[model samples]
Every structure is written in C-alpha cells, then in structure tokens.
Target: MTISSAHPETEPKWWKEATVYQIYPASFKDSNNDGWGDMKGIASKLEYIKDLGADAIWISPFYDSPQDDMGYDIANYEKVWPTYGTNEDCFALIDKTHKLGMKFITDLVINHCSSEHEWFKESRSSKTNPKRDWFFWRAPKGYDADGAPIPPNNWRSYFGGSAWTFDETTNEFYLRLFCSTQPDLNWENEDCRKAIYESAVGYWLDHGVDGFRIDVGSLYSKVVGLPDAPVIDKNTKWQASDAFTMNGPRIHEFHQEMNKFMRDRVKDGREIMTVGEMQHASDETKKLYTSASRHELSELFNFSHTDVELPSSAKTWSHLN
Candidate 1:
C-alpha cells in the first residue's frame, strides 16, 4: 500500500498499509452454536481472516454490559460479557490473532458508561457522593408552561427526546447524550479521567490490546453553562445543535493527554494505534486530529462520506434528487 518515494526518506508505517477488518462479535460467527458469537468463534475464524488478507481486526465491544445499546453501554471494562465467553476466552483470541500475525483492537466506548456501572451507581446515589461530579448533572432551568420541570437546555439526544433525564432521588437532571442508560462521563474531572485510563485504557493496553477506536471522541467536552441550543424549527420541540457539544473547547487538550498516556504505555517501541470516531467533524478538524504534530489521534472516522444522506438544514436531509 506504500508508494515508492523518490526521496526514499518517507515511508508509510505498517498501519498505513494494514487492511483492517471490523468485526461485530455478536454476529460474526457462532462456535458454540448457541445463536451468539463468542471469543471461541473469533478464534475459529483466524484462518479465514488471514486468508481474507486482513492485517488487523477491530472487534466491537464485548465487555460486561446490560445490552441496552448492544455492548456500547459498558458496565465493566475489565470483564468479558458472559454471552461472549470468559476473560480467558478473550485472551485466547488475542493470542491466536497475534500468532496469525494480525493486530487486535477493541472499541473504546468511554464517552458514556452503562448506568448499571458501579461508578454511575455511586454517582447517582447522593448529591454529595464523591463520584457525583463524575457525570454532568444540572438543576432544572425552570418550570414549563404546564408547570412541569424543564431540562437545563433544549438539546436533544441522538436517539430522540431531551438529553437530560430527571433523577427522582436527587431532584436534578443528568445528561445522557445517547441512551438514558448511557450517561456521558465528565472528562473535566481529572480524577474521572485518571480512573478511566487506569481501569479502561491502560488495563487493556497492558493486557496486549493494540489500541482503541475511541467512540464519540469529539464530544467529550461540552460547553460550560449548558446554554440552550438555537431552535431550528419553530414547531419542532427539539433542537439539532452540535455546535456547543461537538469539538468542544478542551477536545485537543484531552486528546493530547490520551496520546501522552498511550505513548508512555508503549515506550518500548511497540506500535500503538488510535482512531477517533468523530461525527460531523470538518475537514480542518480531521486534519488537525490526525496530524502527527498534533499528537491527537492516528486517524479519525468522519461520518460525512459514510452517511447516505446530507443534512440540508438542522431539520431535514437533502437526499439525492
């Protein structure tokens, strides 16, 4: 995949030449034939993957989860999902993949963790909980025309409805950018970031994982003050506003911190890759994200080309006429 350079000084890295195959573990293959694919199934397909000319494989989340949003709502990053098999099975698959000369990577869904996660459970236990600040929780802006408590802003969830969910016990609302069960993490909290690295990123990197495909990498930092998004349609109840959320003020800083950590992990010269999944990022942002001088990410997944339709406005898409 590398082209011959007349200067002979520039050469693309192995990853640049790698043909990566993405595997949705739940549906790839079923070794046990229990109607669900497991680690054993992945192991059984090494020959096929090798023959298919893949140099690396990116497996979707198989971590312990409630399956609310498939395995994206991770409850425990260190443990394997029961239906996907045990931790040993995961290690076995990694070993087999390495033996076959293929790199192994996994999805890093750090933007949000399952509400069932112990961290989230403690965060929601009390307003005074030490972990309470680990998530974005805010007071209601005020009561609506019907006297119902309104969320802090008019921001809508990616799935639908308001992004804020009221907590009965706390009498406050917590932000859930995707599913209500997947509460967004507060990367602003240094302790929270440290814990994520120790428990999620570092843990896997140390256990032989090549790298991560960071989920929602650009949406980690949100605009402070939680301003109401500009309403696109007067009749529509929800606002389609990523201006305040996507590519936030501290995104570069956060990514740099992550890059430093990853570099430190593989100081022994091992190749580690990181690709951020950023939706709606512009070409300029994409360039800055992947530039070596920026030390942000190895690459980025921009949804522009993949999306079948283009958003003509915030309210509607402009499909091919």
Candidate 2:
C-alpha cells in the first residue's frame, strides 16, 4: 500500500486538526421565512459553527434538483438552485466561512445524476444517440428457460423493486442503483468518467471550495458482466440488491484517477480533503479506503456502528474486536 507523502512545505496545519460540521442545508435553519434553509441561512450561522470548535463546514447538496430525493437528484452541476440562492449567494457563504477561518466543503453526488439532467435525457432517447452509452443500458432478456422477459439480473434498487427500469421508448432497461429516476452512469466509458471527474470535481476546485464530501462514492463502477446475484436469504419478500453492485470492480481504479486529477490541479499543493459516504463497508474495506497508499479515499463514513444493535451480539463485538 502506497501512502501519499505530504509535502511539508505545502500542507495546511488546519486540515490535520480540522473538525468538520456537517450542515443538512434543508433542516439547518431558515433565513427568509420560506421555511427552507438556504445559503443565507448558512451564512447567518457561521459564528455558530466557529463557536462549536469546528474548523470547516460540509454543506449538503444545494444544486438545482427535483428534491424528489431531497436534493440527492441534482439537475445542474454548475449552478446553485434558485431556492437555495444564486451562485453569488454561495460565494458569499464561502467568503463568510473563510472570514471565520473555517474552510467550506460541498457534497458531490457523482455515481448518478438526476433523471432530468440533459445527459440522461439524451441517453434515454435512443440507443444510437451520442450519449446513449453514457449510462448503462442493456437489452431486456426476452425469454428464460420458462419463456418470460427476464430482467438483466436479480438486482433490486435501494428504494424498492427492480434496479433495471424498462424504458418504453428505447425498449431497453437502464440500470438505476438508487431510485428509478437516478440512472447510474457508465463509468467504464472513459468519456463518461472523464466528463464527470472534470465537471464535478474540477469545476468546484476552480471555484475555490476547500473540498468535497462524496455521496455514494463507492458505487461509481459496476461489474463488467452485469451478472445476476445469488439469492442467499429467503426470509424477506422484498430485498435490496445493493450488495451485488455497491462497490463494483473498478472502484479503486476510478478513485486513483480522480485523486490524481485533484492533486494535479491544486493551486498551492494543498491536498484536497475528501470523505466518502460508505454505507456498508466492512473493516477490510475501511482499511483499504484509509490506507496511506491506496489512492482511494482519504477518509470514509462507515455506518457499521449506526446499523448494529449494541450490547446484544457478542459476534458483532467480536467482529469489531
């Protein structure tokens, strides 16, 4: 494992000791009496963040989204939602954060884009469209041994039901790891990967934000074969098939490229701090992410503790031990 060597001259002392305050923008506070939190609301709370001993703030997604998934479905990458405020409002918030000696980080949802996004719209139109391959689309299996339209696999979505959504216009099933509207991008396509890496990360880096909190960061890549998953448990009538595609084959390679892109674009050699939201990562996965030389992720948000019922199972305790 190769750990990234910190350049003593360029590293920021604050990063090593930084305490981050995560602000769920919609619920944090409302400023304009609109009953929804916006940039102005965050700006109003800068002193509060500083008073809490945090050195930086990580704001949830505030981009133009349908709000179907509570802002997880981003409609535009470059512009801030009008309900949140203008781009200028974001700049103001950043300025206020820096004035209090706190760095600012924003959420980046790259694994999938809102179904309303232009790329997805185009991709869903026709198979021959230029952007059709931008997302994962597979022909529906017309017949199995029993003769029925078999889904691409036995994968279920995190929300519910099948992960493969049949598009009537194109007669193809597009893979949606999350909600039906959030189509998963095909990271295997170099153009698709490069476009996302540059547009999402590069645009923000150029905008002077300190860093990013990557959402669903591990689901960027899918197993190339797109094979059906084995049904291990039969107790539940409905089950989510996330295990089959969550941390797909090329996740590490994709992250390495993203890391290199980030490092190469740093203005003064300050390492870009990134925290990945890893939902079901095991101890081994955690180590891979945080290992010094992995080039995968700097830090990971593992929800293992949150999911476990404490003091009940010695086996769980043993797993941790």
Candidate 3:
C-alpha cells in the first residue's frame, strides 16, 4: 500500500500505510538454544520481518533490568541486558533493520524502576539522602485524636494492599504505585525528571532507533495533595482511587518537556514518533494527550475496547435487535 497523496503536504501519510509488527523477543525465537531469545535471534529474523511487509518493528523492552516485571523495571536505561545482547549486538540489529528499509521502535517504561536500580536503592537508604527526594516519600500521618499512625491517604496499590510501604530504617513511607520492587520516581523533582528524560530517550537516539512506545506514559506525574479516594465498591478488592493515580496532574508538562528535548535533538528533520499507553483515557483525554500542536504523543492506545465482555453482551444485543 503506497502512502503517496496528490496534496502531499496535507496527507495523513507515513505510519497510516506502514505495516508494523511487535516482537515479544522472549517468545520470538532462540538462536543459540539458550532457552531465551536474544539479539542474534532478532537479527536472524530480520529477513522475515522485512518479507512480511512490515515497514517498522516495535520491540518489547530489552534494557538492563531485573526482569521482575519482564524488563519493564529498568535498572539501567542506557544499556541492553546481557541476556538480550551486548551494545554491539543492538547496533548490529539496528543496521539489519535499516538495511531492510524497516524502522525500529523500543519500549520505554518511565513510571518506575526496579528496586535494584541505583536511584531507588540510594533513595531508600536514608531520609536525609540527596536522592531521597528523587522519589515520593511521606512521614506516617501522625495520630488521630486517639494517637494512631495514619496513612497519608486511602490510596490502594494496583497489585493489592497499600500503595505506601514503611521503611523501618528511615521511619517513613515511600510510595510505590505498582509492585513494591518497582518504586515510582518523583517526576516533580527536576533532577529526577531530567535524568529519566535524557537516559530513556538519549539511549535510543544514540543507537539510531526511530522512536519509542512509552509504557504507562501518563502515570509519570502525581497529584500534589495525595488525597484519599472515596470508596466506590465494597466487593471489589481494588479501589476506584486507582484512576486518580494513573493519569495525574503534571503528566502533560512532563511530556511537553520530553517532546521539546526530542524535537531539539532530531537529526536532519526526522520527526520523533511516540505512542502512549494510557489505561483509562477517554476520547477527549486521548485527543488532549495526542494533539499535534500539544506535542505530547503521536498516538495513544485506548483501553476502552478491552473493557467489553462480548459473549455476555450478546444476549443484550439479541434483545435490542
């Protein structure tokens, strides 16, 4: 499918006509029989990706990580995991992808890092550590009239239980929106924000990657007040408060900063494409995040379609018909 249009200036071209494929790397194929797929495996399969008519390939995370969250909890944003391949292997894959006239995009998870990550380890070391403020922390809400140690709010974690975990050494609670092993970084901290922005985007740009598919992109920033969420349902183990935390207040500002950085660094006028995965975004919210002038994202994946139960709804559909 050629993407040419008569009025090329006004065309919604490029990606619309490009065939793309997602490689889950781990399950794709194992070249050396190491029981895991590595860069060599992907390199060996480049011919197949090209022959299948894919003009671009979106690779799942292969960054240095603990694999606790399947490579989503990046320990080092600048390097590829040894299990995946060396830096040289990544470059070779890039060369191969480009040789076939196909571009490559990688997954970038910015919301949190593995507990083993240097930033998180140092942040949790002491209350007075310089990096402590790099992550969200709070003193245990001290005392009701009855003198009980209250939590900051009624925020529940996505994995289950409280979102705040107490650190006995520091005598405070650190916020982790997801797994305890994956600590959420404080985007409000300029240093933290700058570090993540540079590391995540710079690595790929340096490696000649075309773009990124930002995982949980909207979950980067949080509301300042950290207020309690009202109860929605008693039967559900999860709380409605999860929504307030997912796409928080300052997310747009963070994205704008990232967008500007990418735009400034683009080589030879090539546009840096970005796709955001936001869990509960509405159509208006999606438009706000992906608006061309806003420079937040090139596109966003909406979760509305997955919320439907087709088989159960078929009876209702029959009645309506």
The candidate scoring highest on lDDT is 1
The TM-score values for the models, in the order shown, are 0.93, 0.87, 0.89
In TM-score terms, which candidate is top? 1
User: Model 2, poorest ten-residue lDDT window?
Assistant: 312-321
Residue 86 C-alpha lDDT in model 3: 88
- lDDT (Cα atoms) of all candidates against the true structure: 0.85, 0.78, 0.79
Task: After superposing candidate 3 on the true structure, give the runs of residues whose Cα lies further than 4 Å from its correct spot.
Answer: 6-10, 142-151, 236-238, 309-321
lDDT of each residue in 19-114, candidate 2, tens digit only: 888898888988898978899998998998799888899888898889878888887888888888889999889888878888889898998988
The C-alpha local distance difference test score for the whole of candidate 1 amounts to 0.85
For candidate 2, give the lDDT of residue 276.
Answer: 84
Model 3 clash pairs are none
User: Of models 2 and 3, which has the larger TM-score?
Assistant: 3
**Model 2 alpha-carbon drift over 4 Å, by segment:** 1-13, 143-150, 235-243, 309-321
